[model samples]
Each structure stands twice: as structure tokens, then as C-alpha cells.
Target: MASPIDNNVSSAKAVLLGALASGVNGPTWSMIKITFLTLGVCLAAMLALAFSSSDFIMIIHVLLLVVISGILLVLLNRFLAETGLVSIEQQMEEMGIATKDQIELSKKS
Candidate 1:
């Protein structure tokens, strides 16, 4: 017979994996596209400026900051969403796993 702890571990892993895999199915993939667009728009305009000039150089620096901020925001959002879903699923699984273990232990008794 499997230990209740083993079952819980596997259940937790499965829930987290499924929650993560959910990203592949929809607008979750859209994060890359949006981030890329923001980066391009910010960087390209300054690139179009001639002479490697000081003003445009400063603009390029600001665009780099925007790119960093934009990418970080998207990543944090994705991480939090995935983690929240996994947490909810794990909580639900805990109740079901506990009941099954109780029944198994009762049978053993």
C-alpha cells in the first residue's frame, strides 16, 4: 500500500504541473508577443536618430529601462498567476487525499 505522504507529494506535483501546462493553451503565450512589441517600440525610435547623439543616447537608456521594467512586470504576473492556481488546486486535492488516506487506514485497522 502507498503511504499517504507519497500520495500527497504526487498529487501536489501533478496539480502544479497541470497549472503550469495550462499556459501553453491560450493567451498565456501572448506575454512574449506583448513584451517584444514594447521593447521594439521603445528601442527602435531612438535607433532611427542620427549621429549617436547625446539626446538619443539618453533616450536609448530610458528605453532600456522600459524594456527591463516591462519584461519584469510580465514575468511577475505570470509567476503569481501560475502559483495562485496551483495553490488553489493543491488545497482542493488535500481534502480528497486526506479522505482517501483515512479510508485506507480504517481498512487496515
Candidate 2:
């Protein structure tokens, strides 16, 4: 009785749920945040560069910005881990209240 549109919708929902269920730890979350932040910066930079720079040069600058931002975020993550501060995983677990592994174990009980 389901229409093709309904099937597609359900399939998309399943895929989205599966992605959410996949373990996304603190570093991953940080990187995702960094990517969006970098994107915003790139957009602003592109607007500013539009009049002054060629298309190719603008593209190259954006790429370089992305790479540098990623590297910096990675280093920050490592530094946090290396320090005696609370680990990223612990912070995420605390914020999430219950991780996927915990939920699975609870389900089995």
C-alpha cells in the first residue's frame, strides 16, 4: 500500500538513523564543528576576494585555509589529550549522558 515516495522517505530516515547510531566521538564532533567554522570563514574570505583575486587563486586560498584549519584542530585535540585535562571521550560521554555502547549493554540486560 506504500507509495514509492513513502519508501524513499523511509529509506532516507533509516540511513540517517544509521549514521547517527555510528559512534561519533569527541574528536569527530570537534572536526565537524571545525569544518563548518572553516566553511563560514571561507565564504567570507571568498566574498572579500571576489573583486581582488582571480577564480583560481581564490580556490587555492580556500583550499589552503581548509587544510590549515584541519591541521590546527587536530593539534588542539592532541594537546588536550596529552594534557591532564579531562579527555574528549569523557567529555562527550558526560554530555551525551549515555553512549551507544552503554545503550547496547542496557538493551542486552
Candidate topping TM-score = 2
Note each model's CA RMSD in angstroms.
10.4, 11.3
Task: Give per-residue CA lDDT, model 2, range 1-109, as digits (tens).
Answer: 3323223334334333323544433434455566678776866677568536667776777767767777877776686566533333333344564475854544455
Query: Runs in model 2 with CA error above 4 Å?
Result: 1-54, 86-109
Model 1 Cα lDDT, one tens digit per residue, 1-109: 4434335455435544444544231223344457577776756765555325657767667667667867877796688667543332333345464365555564475
- Give residue 36's error in model 2 in angstroms: 7.4
lDDT of 1 at 36: 71
What's the true lDDT of residue 11 in model 1? Answer: 40
User: What clash pairs does model 2 have?
Assistant: none
Alpha carbon lDDT of residue 12, candidate 1?
39
